[model samples]
Target: MKEKIESKLREKFPNAILEVNDFRGDLTFLVDKNSIVEICKFLRDDEELSFDLLVDLCGVDRAKRKDRFEVVYHIVSLKNRYRVRLKVRVDEKDCVVDSVTSVYPTANWHERETYDMFGITFRNHPDLRRMYMPEEFEYYPLRKDFPLMGIPGSLQLPKR
Candidate 1:
């Protein structure tokens, strides 16, 4: 089941960096950040593989990678009964990926939440603002390097 979807995705997106995480039975593909919108459109609309559901979109911060941020798209095909995960890496200086809200309406809020936590800007995401975090917080807390507690000069920690 996974191989069939992978082959079709390869045929459809030849340049996408494709990988099969067989240990967990997940189809993971990485495409250039700029091509995200195009790739997502193909996945959702292709007749043979109608991945009509955008399950989630989020970011993963790779502390060791030169490109520090990865935007991950979790998609499911209700008609075909298949799933795939798409990833695109972006540099910390330019942590941005194309928004898929136009293709999948559900992506709007997901993108906002991702942006709020990971600081990966979804270009053209409608209402890209902090969904759950306080508005006063200036930095994204989910990045691997972001400090959980401030240094000594800052507020005191809760009693342990």
Candidate 2:
């Protein structure tokens, strides 16, 4: 199953793939952000490889790395009883990635939550806005560099 999925992706997206990792039977592909939407579409539409379920979508912040962020998609083919982990690295300079909401409608909230937490924007998202933080919040609280004690007066408190 892994071989089939890897071969198809390699053949179809030769230039878009960056790295492939298999740890404890879990397969992860780090791919180019530019091809993320197409790759996901193909993954979902392919008849033989029907990845019909998007189990999870989230973001990672790697502040020390040159590409400071990674958006991860955990998708599974319930028919095939297998899953693939797709990842796209995002640079801090251009922290935008094309949204996968078209391919997976459930991605809407995940993308918004990621944006609110990591400050990584998802282009073409239906409603991209803060999920937990206020709209005026200036800093992403989840980043490794965020102050532990919270930003002083970052948000206004209601009079009790």
Candidate 3:
């Protein structure tokens, strides 16, 4: 299954995929961030692959790496009973990527959550807002640089 998916992706988008890994029977692909939406659409619409389910979408903080942020998408093919993980690495300077809500509507909330927690923006998201944080909150809590004890003065109390 991994081989088939890899072959299909390579055939479709040569030089677009950055890396491929097989760990514990799971296939993970690191793809160009600019082509994420196209890649995801192909995975879902392809006849042989049929990755129709978007199980999860999240972000990772790789502060030490040259590309310090990574957006991960876990997709499953109910028809084929297989799963694959797609990753797009974004540089901290440009922590934004094309939204997959057009390809997978389920990504709406997931993208919001990722944005709320990691400060990774999804361009063209219909209603991009913080899902878990207050509208006034200014910091992304999940980033490596966020203080473990939380930000000071973030919470305000009513004046007496």
Instruction: State the TM-score for model 3.
Output: 0.96
Error of 1 at 7 (Å): 2.6
* lDDT tens per residue, model 2, 36-125: 999999999999999989999999988899999999999999899998999999999999999999999999999999999999999999
List model 1 lDDT by residue over 1-160, tens digit each.
6767778777777776545465477778877788788888987888878899999888888988999988889999999888888888889898778899999999999889888888888888878889887676677778877788733443444689
List pairs with backbone clashes in candidate 2.
Answer: none
RMSD of each: 3.5, 1.0, 1.1
lDDT of 3 by residue, 1-160 (tens): 8889999999999988999998998889999999999999999999988999999999999989999999999999999999999999999899899999999999999999999999999999999999998999999999999998888899687899
Poorest lDDT segment (10 consecutive residues) of candidate 2: 147-156
Where is model 1 more than 4 Å wrong at Cα? 18-20, 150-160
Q: How close is candidate 1 to the true structure, as a TM-score?
A: 0.86
Error of 1 at 97 (Å): 0.8
TM-score of each: 0.86, 0.96, 0.96
Show how many residue pairs clash in every candidate, following the order shown.
Answer: 0, 0, 0
Residue-level error in angstroms, candidate 1, position 124 = 1.0
Tell me the TM-score of model 2. Answer: 0.96
